[model samples]
Target: MPLNNIPADRSYTDEHEWIMISPGQTSVPTSPVRVGITSVAAAALGELVFLDLPEVGSEIEAGRTCGEVESTKTVSDLYPPVSGEVTSLNQAAIDDPSLVTQDPYGSGWLFEVQPTQLGTLLTAQEYAEKNGA
Candidate 1:
């Protein structure tokens, strides 16, 4: 199956989450990072139907189960790419989960976090190679 194009600007988790350190932000700890699932993940999930995202101001740890994603195919845990306090959530995606698969990078973003630290992340090339995308 063909996967969606992977953007080169962000870091990705093996579990298929993508994290973009906000523009003009030089460091992970200084600014909020946008979090979302990679297009490959969205495709694999198969027509997302539901989402459970962390609340604003809630502390989230990288690589931990912060929320959940439910698709027609199966349900999967949502893992943060960095540890921090959740700054905001994408209410649009929560209201209509298909945005995740329909526009994985833009309006489909899941949340933003003011990160304290980051977890293991792979470069876009590395992620693509690892997943054979």
Candidate 2:
């Protein structure tokens, strides 16, 4: 799964988060972005133990802890790639954390956002290159 990563095309954060911008989607292009953790993050966490998602309509700041994950007996905070309002959380992921280990980019996605800023993230290729993947 790591070899064929379906990386977010938009940008990422140094904290290992990914953001996908959806333009012409009936909302402000930069406001409501989709956010998730990088595959690197999932791999580091090993088998997921638990997940906590933000309530819908909550405002989140970039680099701030919005949620958390418990894996391998350790808890890690989930960071936002960009500032935004959470529009939706991945209910499926909340139900099953193991999916994060199986498909970090697909079924493991954490939440969707209405980004307040999209310029503050790194590109998918850039993030992979930075992490030496």
- Full-model lDDT for every candidate: 0.88, 0.73
The CA root-mean-square deviation of candidate 1, after full C-alpha superposition on the true structure, stands at 3.3
User: Per-candidate TM vs. native?
Assistant: 0.91, 0.83
Candidate 1 residue-wise lDDT, 17-61, digit = tens: 999853233466677879999988898889999999999999999
Task: Give the per-residue lDDT digits (tens) of candidate 2, residues 42-120.
Answer: 8888889798878899988877788898898689898886666889888888898898778776777788988665445
Against the true structure, candidate 2 has what lDDT? Answer: 0.73
Question: In model 2, what is the error at residue 60, expressed in angstroms?
Answer: 0.3
Indicate the residue-level lDDT of 82 in model 2. Answer: 66
Candidate 1: pairs in clash: none
After superposing candidate 1, which stretches have Cα over 4 Å from the reference? 1-4, 22-26
